[model samples]
Target: GQQVMQIPQYQHVQEGEDFTTYCNSSTTLSNIQWYKQRPGGHPVFLIQLVKSGEVKKQKRLTFQFGEAKKNSSLHITATQTTDVGTYFCAGSTGGFKTIFGAGTRLFVKA
Candidate 1:
């Protein structure tokens, strides 16, 4: 069985600050996905990384996959109240099921 784990289960930052969350897996993964769940909302897919050491970005957000395919990270630059939510990293070991990490909750203050 494979498992995905995220660090700093929670993060709190003032507006305009930066935040980051790390994810690790128990086994090598074929692909890794990132999702964001806004308060009172469902998880929404943000991005997916399949290549070793892959990196992607969307405006102020950045994502990375480890070369070993067993780890990942997400970083948000310039925090805003609208960015408050839970971020989750999911990994698939070339299987039908994708294991998700305990989401990292982000709290932003003005």
Candidate 2:
């Protein structure tokens, strides 16, 4: 069985600050995806990393996959009210099933 886990389940930041969340998997993953879910909203796809040690960025957000393909991370450069959400990392083992980490809840203060 495959499993994905995330740490620091919750984070709080002030405006202009930074935040980060980490995810780990029990088995090597073929690919990993990140998602963001706003309060009272559904999860929205952010990015996907397939290559080992790959890193990608979008505006103030950065995503990374570990060299072993069993870990990943998401970092937000500056905090904002709009950035408040729960972040999730999902890992797939080259199959239809994907294991999702226990989302990290982020709260930003203005």
Candidate 3:
């Protein structure tokens, strides 16, 4: 059986602060996908990594994949009110069933 886990189900930060979220899978994954969803909005794909030790960055945000393909992390620097949303990580175990980690919801205060 495969399972996905995430930390700090919720986070609150003031503007100009920083935030980080982590994701872990119980089994080795073939690929890891990160997504973000704004309030009342659908999940939007952010990035996906298939190779070991892959890292990607978008502006003030950084994403990383574990060497074992069973974990990942997302870090955001200089948070803003517009950065308020829920982040989710999904892992695929070389099959159709993709498991999503418990999302980490972020609240940014102005």
Candidate 4:
């Protein structure tokens, strides 16, 4: 069975600071989907990375895939209060079944 693991379970950052979360899978991942879930809200798709060594960015957020295709990371530049949420990484093996990580909850102090 394939499994995805996310690091730091939780993170607390001051507004204007930087934040990052890591993800790793037991098997090579065909694609990784990132999502953000706010308090009492559903998870919203953030972005997806497919190619090994791929990097994508949205505003102050950056996503990266490892060359080994088994790891990923998300970094946010100058964290803001709006960034407070639980970030999840979902690893898919050729679009069959996607395994979601435990997610890293981020708390931003304004």
Candidate 5:
């Protein structure tokens, strides 16, 4: 069995402040996918990190995959009210099996 874990189960940041969430897996992953689910909205795919030690960014957001392929992180450079959401990390071991982390709920205060 495999498991994906995420932390800082909840985060609260003032507008313009930075925030981050981390994810870890019990076993090495083939790829890791990040998603954000807004209030009352379904999870929307953000990005996928497939290479070890890979890093990607989308505007104010940055994503990273561990060198071991067993950890990942998502960082927001500046918090905004619209950034409030539950961020989830899904680690795929190969084939069709993917384990999702519990998710980190982010609250951006204005």
Candidate 6:
């Protein structure tokens, strides 16, 4: 069976600080997707990396894919109160049944 795991089940950061979360899978992943869910909000797609050693960035956020395709990471340069949410990683083996990781919950303090 395929499984996706994440680190730091919970994190608390002060405004203007930095935060990082990691994700790993037990099997080779065909593709991986990152999502973020705000407090009392639904999960929204952030980005997806399918190629090995790929790096993508969006403003203050960055995403990296492991060269082996079994791990990934998300980093936020400067934390903000609006950044409070849960980050999740999902893996797909080329079809349905994508496995979602247990998400890293973040709490940003004012």
Query: lDDT per prediction?
Result: 0.95, 0.94, 0.94, 0.97, 0.96, 0.94
lDDT comparison, 1 vs 3, better candidate: 1
**lDDT tens digits, residue span 1-110, model 3:** 78999998999999999999999999989999999999999999999989999999999999999999989999999999989999999999888888888899999999
Model 2, range 14-66, lDDT digits (tens) per residue? 98999999999999999999999998999999999999999999999999999
What is the per-residue lDDT of model 6 for residues 67-108, given as tens digits with 9 covering 90 to 100?
999999999998989889999999997898889999999999
78, model 3: CA deviation in Å?
0.4
What is the alpha-carbon lDDT of model 1 when measured against the actual structure? Answer: 0.95
- On lDDT, the candidate that comes out on top is 4
On lDDT, the stronger of 2 and 4 is 4
Per-residue C-alpha lDDT of model 4 across residues 1-85, encoded as one tens digit per residue: 8889999999999999999999999999999999999999999999999999999999999999999999999999999999999
Candidate 2's TM-score reads 0.98
lDDT of 1 by residue, 1-110 (tens): 67788998999899999999999999999999999999899999999999999999999999999999999999999998999999999999987899999999999999
- What TM-score does structure 6 among the candidates reach? 0.97
Superpose all Cα atoms of candidate 3 onto the true structure and report the RMSD in Å to 1 decimal: 0.8
**CA-only RMSD, every prediction:** 0.6, 0.6, 0.8, 0.6, 0.6, 0.7
TM-score of each: 0.98, 0.98, 0.96, 0.98, 0.98, 0.97
Colliding pairs, model 1: none
lDDT of 4 at 12: 92
For each candidate, how many residue pairs have backbone atoms clashing (under 3 Å)?
0, 0, 0, 0, 0, 0
Model 2 global lDDT (CA atoms, 0 to 1): 0.94
Model 5 residue runs over 4 Å out of place are: none
In model 1, where is the ten-residue run with the lowest total lDDT?
Answer: 1-10
Worst 10 residues of 5 by lDDT: 91-100
Q: Determine which window of 10 residues in candidate 6 has minimal summed lDDT.
A: 89-98
Clashes counted in candidate 1 amount to: 0
Give the clashing residue pairs of candidate 5, or none: none
